[model samples]
Target: MGRPLIHRSPMPGLGLSMGITLTMLSLVVLLPIGALLLKGANYGLAGMWDTVNRPRVWAALYLSFRLSLFAALFN
Candidate 1:
């Protein structure tokens, strides 16, 4: 019987891999979040409730819920 081939990665290459992962995360994830951070940081509970319970927002939320319910049943 033949044994399956196992690939071995070098130990020192681990540091390089870690550096690449951290750099990718910091640049790709952290660079473009100023708006999201500001929005979330500025949101108050009363303002959130007011926005959600408004007439237009409530209509859209109701429609989304019904559509998602039907889609889930079939999908």
Candidate 2:
């Protein structure tokens, strides 16, 4: 048997609200991630690996991580 209907919400415009929420979420979250993925694809796996493996990249990453850790500890 089908489930009994529950009480309906008194609120209106749920469809419009959901559309706006999805649009905002896609623009704010998905677009940048998609761009990053496209960039990585263009760079290719070996190129990305080489870039990350560079000494300067490693140093900068290490410094950033250390600074973030220090800030977190301070806070």
Candidate 3:
């Protein structure tokens, strides 16, 4: 006969592992993005456009793009 589908095996502590993983994912990944989105929502489209159009922002973006491209090429 085939084995039962939902039988528990030898593994343990899965819930603890999942909880820690989800907590870290929220803190490390989700929180900063949420904060950035909230800040942008408060700033509104016109303010964001003004900030994006500035020379300093353009230079920084260009530098970031170049660095990313360089790293991608090496990879």
Q: Which stretches of candidate 3 lie over 4 Å from their true place?
A: 1-25
What is residue 67's positional error in candidate 3, in angstroms? 0.4
TM-score of 1: 0.44
Q: How far is each candidate from the true structure, as Cα RMSD in Å?
A: 8.3, 5.6, 4.0
| Model 1 bad stretches (over 4 Å) | 1-37
lDDT of 3 by residue, 1-75 (tens): 997798775668888898999999999999999998899988899988898899999999999999999999999
Question: What is the alpha-carbon lDDT of model 1 when measured against the actual structure?
Answer: 0.81
Query: In candidate 1, residue 31 scores what lDDT?
Result: 63
Residue range with the least summed lDDT across 10 consecutive positions in model 3:
3-12
Sequence-dependent TM-score of model 2: 0.54
For model 1, residues 1-75, the per-residue Cα lDDT tens digits are 899988877675898899999999888888667655567467777776666688998899899999999999999
| Per-residue accuracy of model 2 over 38-72 as CA lDDT, tens digit each | 89888899988988899999999999999999999
Q: At residue 29, what lDDT does model 1 achieve?
A: 86
**Alpha-carbon error at 40 in model 1, in Å?**
4.7
